[model samples]
Target: MITSPIWLPATLMAGATQAWRTAVQRRVGKTLSINAAGLVRYLYGIPFALILLGGYQLLFPAPFPVLGRLFLPFCLAGGLAQIIATNLLIMAFGHRNFVVGTAYSKTEAVQGAILSFLLMGERLSTLTCAGIGCGVAGVMLLSTGGKRMGPMDFLRALGQPAAITGIASGFFFALTAIGIRRATQEVGGGDPIHAALIVLSVTVLLQTLLQGGYLALREPGEMRKVFTSWRVSGQVGFLSAMGSACWFTGFATAPVALVRIVGQIEVAFTMAFGHFYLGERMARSEAMGLMLVACGVVLALLGAL
Candidate 1:
């Protein structure tokens, strides 16, 4: 069995790298269509993912794990779910400012917790559930931009285009995590990292083919822009590969809910990137919301212990 401690560092790495990659992907979205922007990561990331898998094999040689019958279905489902989640997230970005857009999607932790429980029979401690609640409340608070609104107004706010797309994105992302974790388990191996990398490699390759083919048929012209914007697109791809590797590792080693709870740190990173890197101004409420998210993460960690 994989040691539990490995998930923490892997999740931290995943959060930081994912924040950076999403910021870069948002930049690419400015020049390309939503699907085209979504395609950039997978298209450029496949090579780096392969290299990581190859390098790991060379450093610590092992026979490739035999795939189970369910592996392809899980990988394909995970890959497709991620594609839709990514596009919806990009669409959310269009509906609101970057930071708020991301905050809206931070709901995935709670959603993943629920889905994991219902689908995988994973249970959470009371403290972890509270942490997930805190995180969700913080995200909702951020969505309001610190305005004082009644229940009705808040309900309306949740119905806004950004909220709808963001929540949908979270749901699909939860599905992706579940699918990925299940896929890795199907490998029947003791080396969690090896299984994670193999899943990562296959998932990314499938994503590239699925998204690339859609773009090729529907938006052929954008394909040129995707390649020509190589400088930025390449950075996105590399970070995406690295981030995904870490995320897959976390999934392989820990409960999906726990990994996702810790991964909420991405919201903190996203806010920092928004303020400093993108020149987006943060309101007082946004800062408060971030603190709540941090508290939630702390609670979840303590509960894990």
Candidate 2:
């Protein structure tokens, strides 16, 4: 069994930084196209990711791990999935407020659990399953816009554009998580942190190439805007790198399902940022939903014990 104290703090940091990065991405989307906005994180984050990997190497003085044949494939798959997932997420944001859009995507936790089990043969404890259940329920409630609704009405709500895009985002994000974990596992020797950082750097670089190349061919004008809007895009890049480093650390150190379950705390951080930073009003039902997500986090952590 994989166990590490680093996973908890790393997941927490990932959640916090991701929330901030996503919110900033939403802002960047206002001026840029969906694909352009999505590119901001990867294209701008390359430098930060490389700097982080270099710093870690200098500090630890570990030999680089040998890359297995699967490493490049995993990075490509994970990077591409993340690019699609992020674009879908940004699209979802257009259909709803940041908090609700993100809440819907929190379904990634449950989806990650299922994908991890089927693809990687990872299993969750009953308590962890229960926690994932609670988180999904809370996310469902949040999708209702805090209004009381019948079962059928709630079901219909799930069919909304925002819900569809958000759920699709969740599915791809789950794939991304599994890919990252598997890629990290393919690394031979070296510190797990070093392995994770290497995977992160490679994944980010690949994503930059793929997404940047697409923008260059399809929308050459947006490429200029991407560089011109560096003021805000730069922040998104830095936060994305920081958040991804932590997420890769968590994935390297624990089961992807567990890491993602704890990472559901990002919803709470998203809600806080939406309300305070973005001046968005919170509904009572949203608060209730957040409470359920928090309880789920606690239960998941307990199950990890």
TM-score of every candidate relative to the true structure = 0.98, 0.99
Residue-level lDDT tens digits of model 1 in 51-103: 99999999999887889999999999999999999999999999999988888
- Collision pairs in model 1: none
> Which regions of candidate 1 fall more than 4 Å away from where they truly are?
1-3
Residue pairs clashing in model 2 are: none
Q: Model 2's lDDT to the true fold?
A: 0.92
lDDT of 2 by residue, 62-103 (tens): 678899999999989999999999999999999999998998
Q: Give the Cα error of residue 297 in candidate 2, in Å.
A: 0.6
For model 1, the local distance difference test gives 0.92
In model 2, the worst 10-residue window by lDDT is 1-10
Give per-model CA RMSD: 1.2, 0.8
